[model samples]
Target: MKDLIKESISDLKKSDGFVYVTAEGEKIDLHEAAAKGIAVTPVNPKSEVIKKLEAAGLDLTDSKFLNDLNELISLLSGSGSTKGKSGKRRTFSDSEKSKIVEEWKKVEAAGKKTKAAFAREIGVGYQTFINWLRD
Candidate 1:
């Protein structure tokens, strides 16, 4: 039975849509079936996944079930407590900063009040530009 369940799950993962039939012959949509599958898992999930599951008809009143479903979804999505963080913070050289500041000055002299547009022109956030001005 476990093997059959695993096989069904694998099939569901591979297919874009799956139709599930209940004992009483009620047809469940792909989203609802996915939600039911998620609900039976042993881990807690993220809020987004929980929202989707709730939309698919899972009762959020059962906290244990909701938590498990969320965890399962997070694991399946390759995220959550198990995933490692990556990527380094971007840094600008002094010369690069000077060049950006000069461009910002030119924009200011042109009487442009759109800080966002000036920031985009120099490839930085408006807040970052404001911080650069302070520096």
Candidate 2:
């Protein structure tokens, strides 16, 4: 079982394909994989081997490898968490954030007159003004 787990991890490291096996074969738990910077997919949770691995030394509460594991799982299974296809959310860059803030300032200046009128003057939706204010 241990060998199978090792093999599965090794294979995942080398390939983009999923490691499919019988329910009784060695499996790595999604939590363990996540901790180890490996992504475990939904298919992994169903493998009895993964359950067994979870019974071993791996700790699910560990956060270090969760992201990598999730990414690996997504890469294999073609499904991902709500964050998107990468199994994680992509945040705006510093430059993008700064630009948004600058744009917001301009929008706010125009909004001082009236939301609807300012939106029309800027050729933007009224909701854009609201969104900028929230940001």
Candidate 3:
């Protein structure tokens, strides 16, 4: 998975606005969304997510949306508004996963922290963050 991200994502062969991820892996299907470089789900135009995104002056679509979602989720968790911090594992929606991936990229591009640092900052295990990126 890391190889795919490092290679396929780096290649970014865009065909008709869609990137073709050709990394070879048993679970990496070229037809799947990940293999096509669609790392995030698009929010409905009228959905609350879109509204919040617009209110926050963020793009209503694409990576920006995913990043904002992660930011919001992180803020909620830190503010004690979400119970996801409980010892039990919390299931994240597809959208949430997308958000996490975007946020991970954002932090990584900043070049100030390692993967472990990011996990600690987000109150999650290092492997968990890597798993999120893997998915």
Q: Specify the highest-TM-score model's number.
A: 3
Cα lDDT tens digits for candidate 1, 12-108: 5654443345555454554666777733222212333345445666767798787777768866774443223233445789898888888778878
Report the Cα lDDT for residue 26, model 2: 44
Q: Of the pair 1 and 3, which is ahead by lDDT?
A: 1
Which is better, 2 or 3, measured by lDDT? 3
lDDT of each: 0.60, 0.54, 0.59
12 in model 1: Cα distance from truth in Å? 19
User: What is the TM-score of each predicted model, taking all chains together?
Assistant: 0.34, 0.21, 0.35
The candidate that achieves the highest lDDT relative to the unseen native structure: 1
lDDT of 3 by residue, 18-120 (tens): 3333334122333576556744433222343344445656565778567656668777776323334556866678898788779989888988878887777
lDDT of 2 at 44: 36
Backbone clashes counted, model 2? 5
Misplaced by over 4 Å in model 2 are: 1-8, 23-42, 45-52, 64-135
List clashing residue pairs in candidate 2: 27-49, 34-65, 34-66, 38-69, 39-69
Question: Which pairs of residues collide in candidate 1?
Answer: 43-68, 44-67, 44-70, 44-71, 45-70, 45-71
